[model samples]
Target: MRIRIVGTGRAVPAERLTTRALEAKLSLAEGALEAVTGVVERYVCSAESQIDLACAAAALALADAGVEPGAVDLIIGGCGVPYQPLPATAPLGMQRLGMADGAAAAFD
Candidate 1:
């Protein structure tokens, strides 16, 4: 059998926090965050949680692939900055994707 990638998706929060804004909020010197991290802006969760974001992206991926949630066989997930180190992200993603237990294998 040939293994193939069938779908892909991504998601970011609606709220945006710029480095300058963060600096001002933290009362740090101008360009402090940028000087240290070289990051100018980033998305912050306004109402969505990590699961919500992951699920949103996953939903899109499912749509793109034209696959139903039950058709999924596996899920691989990783958090750039993991919130909860325990309970791998992929299973949670599978749950959010509406897959029942044992419906799909998962890995973090």
Candidate 2:
């Protein structure tokens, strides 16, 4: 059997959270956030909903895989933060991607 990485994707926030920004927002010392998180800069999706980011990533992944939107056998979306308290993010992603009208099963 041959195994291939058919699709791969990543989700990044539309906005960027810089060390300076964090310091200002949290009123912390310079580099305090980076020291604690070990990250100088990070993407923040707080501005946009999680479902939106997932859909974007999924679209890119499907395109890279060279597969039609209707050809996907399965879709799995995982995230620590979800857009809403209820309703899994994957269904919203599928709907946004125009993949199958809320037919895909989603896992947290």
Candidate 3:
């Protein structure tokens, strides 16, 4: 079977931490981290857990696909490592996405 990607989404935290701030926090010289990493800034999650971000992104993806969550037949969570071990994150993600029943969930 061929897999077709219908839509994509991303959820970033409200907090924006710049390289300068990170460098200070790491006690590195100004511009040192960015010079090597090429990362100017990063989103830092404060209130939202990783699951919250995933669910928000999933909502956006579903909306972008012009389909309700019930339309999804399967949920495949990638990135290997769960944010924390215990009560697999995919099922939680499926529930958060409104996949109350019928959808199969898995992780890679």
Error of 2 at 102 (Å): 6.7
Cα lDDT over the full model 1: 0.86
Q: How well does candidate 2 match the true structure in TM-score terms?
A: 0.77
Number of backbone-clashing residue pairs for each candidate, in the order shown: 0, 0, 0
The lDDT per prediction is: 0.86, 0.74, 0.80
Off by over 4 Å in 1: 83-86
Worst 10 residues of 2 by lDDT: 99-108
What's each prediction's TM-score?
A: 0.82, 0.77, 0.85
* Tens digit of per-residue lDDT, candidate 3, span 71-93: 77677766445776655677778
Instruction: Assess the local accuracy of residue 98 in candidate 2 as a C-alpha lDDT between 0 and 100.
Output: 78
C-alpha lDDT of candidate 2 relative to the true structure = 0.74
The lDDT leader among the candidates is 1
**How would you encode candidate 1's per-residue C-alpha lDDT over 1-108 as one tens digit per residue?**
676778888999999999999999999999989999999999999898888888999998989998898998778787887757777788888877778988989878
Q: What residue pairs clash in candidate 2, if any at all?
A: none
